[model samples]
Target: MRVVHVASEVFPFSRSGGLGDVLGALPAQQARLGAQVTVVSPWYADITQAVREVWRGPLEVPGSVPLTDVRVGAFTEGGVQFLFVGLDAFDRPGLYFPDDVWRFTQFGRAVLPALEQVGVVPDVLHGHDWQAGLVVARARLAGLRAVFSVHNLQYQGRWNLMDGVGWTGLPDGVFTAEGLEFHGDVNLMKAGLVFASQVTTVSPTYAQEITTPEYGEGLDGLLIRLTHEGRLSGILNGLDQERWDPRTDADITPFGQLAGKAACGAALRAEFGLDDAPILATVSRLAEQKGMDLLIAALPELTRAWNVVVLGGGDPRLEAGLREWDAHPRVAFAQGMNEPLAHRIYAGADAFAMPSRFEPCGLSQMIAMRYGTLPVVRETGGLVDTVPHEVGFRFAGATPEALADACAAARLTFDDHAEWAARAQEAMSLDFSWDGPTREYLGLYARVLSGPLRPLVGLERA
Candidate 1:
């Protein structure tokens, strides 16, 4: 099977979050499984890290208004192919620029023509998030098979109706309440949700959660409708084990190098000047959605028994909370993403804290488990699917009390040496490999090819 993936971000080229990681690993993994995959993403101005494989075509995005020139290029490395949409439109600093909708609109429209230039029409075009949502809509309108993946529902690309309709030349009918319209604005994510042959989120539990009003981010009604029509589904995301394995990591002192987690933890504690208490670490964006507020609220009670370390940065209010908690001698907070430090922390920490309010197939908990660090997480989204009692500790709610209870359980378990060792070993053995999820995605693709939803309703001009 041939798959063309469209997204705003792909790691090593451009990235802001987990979406990039997924696209980076999954396409390569899928290729390894014998499916031909090519990903189309914007070529940002600051992307100087990757050398171009070949310059394919200096092509024009067909039927484009305010006619702009864009060069289509190819990049083949590590067994996966990449078709980069290169033009001044995307030649901007940072992951997000001033006119994002305009940039992605041009990007979405460029896929088919670029593919044509390369002489390959894929069996499926997979769109990720609102950034590439329009691609799925455009593909389906042109009667091509397409699949859409919703990484996060919170940031739907919304713009004025006139601007969106004019820039993309999308049919007027597609801007209605039943289409891409959200309130008074044109929502880009709606294109994928309403027009694709099938819509999928990162995890099955999140797929179920998004269909409800509680976790839907205001698109629950439509998602529920899609679910009822059998057009909505979920496939859990997987890990790139090559980079996450503790045994071979050069940055972190491996278990083989040190006697094990005990010696490693002692060294890390001494290195960070932290107390020798059982280490509980969190590595995530400090946002309310990640339940950072709950972690903060439970800090006083938690730090009394366990030493804490945190990595990642987001939201000023969250930073202030972390600063306030830093007053506690046992708690150490490190801001921003440090690949080496993260690996070391995961390897050294006794328990990993991921008290997320709503996680869409979180990879950190899985990574922590792989490094022999049992996770203490809320029973939400991928956390529940991946972390069971046999492997890690879990709580039922997003509240502070619930998180406190779970942490207490973790602390109690940590006090029991034999039990803790067994659980850590069990967690390390849990498989979150790409093989299973990749196979599931392939199956979904085959199913869609066998019976694709044609003439996707509510896309034509009224």
Candidate 2:
């Protein structure tokens, strides 16, 4: 089957978060599964400098503004073709900018033409997040099956109705209540939800959670209808096992050798000047959604018994809050993204803490578990699906006390070396690889292709 994945980011080339990681790993895995895959992403400044361009030409983009300079380029990697759409707007430093609504709309408009230019037609056009949302409708117009994946419900691409219509060159009628409209604004996420042949989220629990009022982010009614129509489902995200494997990772001691983990742990403790207490590490963005605030609040009680190491930076207020703990004897806070340190933390820490208020599907916990580090997470989203009690610690309620209780339970297990080792071994043994999720995606695509084509909503007259 021929498949095309449209997203704003892809790992190792350009990425801001999990969306990049997903696109990076999933398409490659799909190619390995005997499917021809193509990934379409913006050619940002950082990526332009790294890759040798294979193809480049002017792109046909719809809108009032004459986009004569818009171009598309291509490169091949890991058996998958990558097409990068370029515009002066995309030449900016970051993957996402303030004018993203206009930028991605243009990117989405270029996808089909770019594919045509490259002489590839896909059986399914898979779009990720709000950035690629507009592509789904365009794919349907081209008589192709389209699948839309919602990585997070909170970040719907919303803008003025007139602006969205103008940018997309879509009819004003498509901006109504049953279409892209959300509170009188044009929501690109809603466009995907309304137009796609199938809609999926990261995890099973999250799929269910998003259909409810609590986690729906004000789109529960629509999600509920989609669920009933049998057009919506969830497939859990998987780790790139080769990249995260403890047995062969070059960054840390290979697990095959005896005392490798222990030696690494000792070195980590020394690096942080931490005493020989159970080390709890977190490699995450410092944001309230990640439950960093709760971690901060629980620090006083937690530091009394365990040493904590934090690696990540976001939300200046949260950064300030965590920095205060830097002076504490048992706390080590390193702000900003450090890939090498993250790998070391995963290998050396006794347990990983991801007390997210709501996590769709977290890669960090999976990565931690791959290194035989038990995850202590709150019971929500994919955290509930991946981290069973046998493998790690879990707690309910998004409170400091709840996180502390889970950590306390983990501390108890840590004190019992044999028990901790057994649990860690179980976690390490569990499969979180991309093979299964890739198969599920292929199945979804087949189902979409076999099913009767539903009438396009919003874009057509009833």
Give one digit per residue, the lDDT tens place, for model 1 in 344-419.
8988898899999899899999898888888999998888888987879899888999998999998988889888
TM-score of 1: 0.94
* Model 1: how far residue 237 lies from native, Å: 0.7
List model 2 lDDT by residue over 1-462, tens digit each: 999999999987898788999998999999999999999888888885345455466665666555666566677889988888887788767777778888888887877877787688988999999998889877776677899999999999899887777788666667779888889788989888988999999999999999999999999999999999998999999998988888888887778533468877987898899998989999998899999999999998898789999999989999998898899989999999888888899999989999998999999999998888899999999999999899899999899999999899999888898888889888888899999999999999999999988786545741
**Candidate 1 local Cα displacement, residue 429, angstroms:** 0.6
Q: Identify the candidate with maximal TM-score.
A: 2
Query: Looking at candidate 2, what is the lDDT of residue 354?
Result: 94
Task: Quote the positional error of residue 130 for candidate 2 in Å.
Answer: 0.6
Per-candidate count of clashing residue pairs (backbone under 3 Å)? 0, 0
Worst 10 residues of 2 by lDDT: 48-57
